[model samples]
Each structure stands twice: as C-alpha cells, then as structure tokens.
Target: MPGIHITDIEAAINFWRERRPSADGFTLALPVQALASLYARMVFQRQDLADEQAFSAAAWAAWQTWYASTPDTPCIAICSTSQGDAVCKGCGRTESEVQYWPEMGPAEKRSTWRRITAEGTAWRFNRYAERARETQRSNAGNS
Candidate 1:
C-alpha cells in the first residue's frame, strides 16, 4: 500500500493532538498516541526504530479516516477522452481509467491521482493549476 505523505501524517498528528486533551482515558487516545509516534518516526526518517508493517497499517488506517472527510476526484470537467483521445489532456487519465473510475477502488484511484500529479503533464496540473486554485479560493471566499 502507498504510504500517506509526510505532510498528511503531520496533519493527522495535529488532528489527534488537538483532540487528545479531552480524550484522556478513552480508547481512541492510545491509538492516537501510537499514530503520533509512528508519524514522528517517519518524519524524522527513523523507520529503523519502528516496525514497517505496523507503521504502514496504522498510516493506511489514519489515511482512510482522514480521506473519508474529503474524498478527492481528479476530474476537472474537461475530459478529452470523451472526444476519443487516449489520454485526457485535462486530468491526464487514460480512456480506460476514465471509463473505470467509478468502479475503481480507493487505492486504484489514489494511484492514478499520484501518477497524474507527479507527471504534471495534464492541463489541470500544468497549464491551469494556479487558475484552478484561484478559482477555488474565490469560491471558498464566497462561501
């Protein structure tokens, strides 16, 4: 399984910490502490101090929990695949990926998201990322 990003782990740690003081003696507190420790080891590049399998499992669980609140989709509504393009110029997903998106599992979708973002070849990420961000900011401000 792909590990959560360092930044995400950091965010999760903050999330847990913010709720920790009020969570004393609770079942969730132990897991939250464990997660924080594991995340800290990862951030400091000290994987040797922790079990990799354990860390992966904990991170995956934490990621799933966090992602439930903000499920992301890569579609920017300009799919070139609809016009018979093999790869979408907008989102960089292939025709098959676009067709199977609704059926793809979370891991598969995340893999595609990571690929597109890393490649940075799509119009969404390359040519219009700033514009998209600005638009999102504008929309958020209005809301």
Candidate 2:
C-alpha cells in the first residue's frame, strides 16, 4: 500500500461524500512524511519520459486515477478529546460526532466536513505563523 498523500486523502473523502468513485485508493496508515516520500518516488518513476509536456499531462492523469480510489475520512479526533476538549481541535467535532462518524448520513457527514475544513485551515495558518516566528527568532540570534 502506498502512503497516503494529503491531497489524495482529501480527494478520496470528497469523492466518497459525493458518492463518486475515485480513480485509485488513497487509504494509507503511514505518517505524512512517509506518504510524501512515496509521492516523491512515484514522481521519480516517471523520469524516463523524454517529453516534459507529455509527462506533465500524464502526471495529471495519473493523479486523477489515484485520487479516485482513496478511502474516506479517518479522523476520530480522539487526541483532542483526551486533552479535555469536548470538541476535536482538528474537526471541531464533539465526542458524539466522532463516535457517530461512521454511521452518519452522507448529508450530515458533509456538513461536518465543512467544519473540519474550516478548522484545518485555521490550524494550518497558526502552525505556519508559529514556524515563521521561530525561524525569525533563530535567525536573529545567529546574526
């Protein structure tokens, strides 16, 4: 099983909610860095192509096929709950939401996804800001 890319996971979850089949399976139990390595390996495998433009075109086709087969969401938000937060920091979901995630109707689950996406974007921005600040401070000390 190939490690799951973030983009692939998104595509698979979206495709599942939309009731459409993706071109490939995106379910991977590996960590993000591992999945990134897999993606890098896949890109290298296509290095034999002589035509850059043709290769680019094929890459998109390949991605689409892979995205079609990925599995649905796996976020249970347990780590957050364990930290005493009633709602998941990742998905903004309550304990019930996490427990009922699998049994949820498509419409309800999609609504939950919207909240999850919103929270994820916010979390990403905050993380990026923190990293930038840390880098800046480290550079200041070195200069």
Candidate 3:
C-alpha cells in the first residue's frame, strides 16, 4: 500500500489551517486538530510516512476533507503523452500516470502533482506557456 508522505500531511495541515483558522491563537480547528495529532505522532515516531490503513477515523476524515479541496489534476490541456512520450512535456506526468489517472486515488494523484511541481520542468510551467503567447502574437501580427 502507498504510504502517505509527511509533506502531504503538512500540506493538508496548512489547508485546514487556512480554511478553519482558530478563533484564538492557541486552539486548533477541528480538522487541523485531527491532522495535527497525526502529524505530531509522525514527528514523535520519527517516521516520514504514515500508513493509510493505520489512520484513525478522525485523521482519515480530516485528510479526506483536505484532499477534496485540492485540484484533482495538473493537466493544462496540453497533453504530450498522446504522441508516445514516456513523460509528458506539457503536464510532466508519466505515460502510465496519464493512462491511469482516472483510477488513481487522491494520495497517488497528489504524489504525482508533488513530484511534477517540484521538478518544474513541465511545458505548462515553462516553454509551452511562452509558446502559447508567441502563437497568439504571431496570429495577431498576421492579421
């Protein structure tokens, strides 16, 4: 089973913190409390990943709630995986990821997103974005 990375937990914590900030500086929002408890345990245990099956009901529920708020995919509608690229130039997803995205779980999708975002090599983040503007400029100049 794919373990939940600590970074994902941290992101979820931040999400809940923003969505449900405590009225007082001392107290945590319910979802934040739930996820924070999990985060605390992970830190205390010195574990970088958490077992999904081991999650407490509240932790799982809190995580699910946070997950729902995140974007589902990183697709910029410029898929290069269609032309047989092992990794998509546009979205920065592996061909397997593109093929199986519909079936991937929230955690799996998030993991892919984390990797792609960290790499920052996707065309959508770089050249492909500039290329679109250039194309528009070319069209405007022609007319």
The TM-score values for the models, in the order shown, are 0.58, 0.34, 0.83
**Local accuracy of candidate 3 as per-residue lDDT tens digits, 1-143:** 56788888898889888988889888998778888898999999999878887578888998988788878888888888898889999899999999999999876887788789899999877987789899999999999
**lDDT tens string, model 2, 29-120?**
22322333434554677431122122244343443444435334535323475677777664467778777778964335545655566666
Candidate 2: where is the Cα deviation over 4 Å? 1-71, 74-78, 119-143
C-alpha local distance difference test of each model: 0.70, 0.48, 0.86
Each prediction's total of clashing residue pairs, residues at least 3 apart in sequence or on different chains, is 0, 9, 0
What are the runs in model 3 whose C-alpha is more than 4 Å off?
A: 128-143
Location of the lowest summed lDDT over 10 successive residues in candidate 3 = 48-57
- By the lDDT metric, which is better: model 1 or model 3? 3
How far residue 37's Cα lies from its native spot in candidate 1, in Å, is: 7.2
What is model 1's C-alpha RMSD?
Answer: 5.4
Which scores greater on lDDT, model 2 or model 3?
3
Misplaced by over 4 Å in model 1 are 1-31, 34-61, 133-143
* Count: clashes, candidate 2: 9
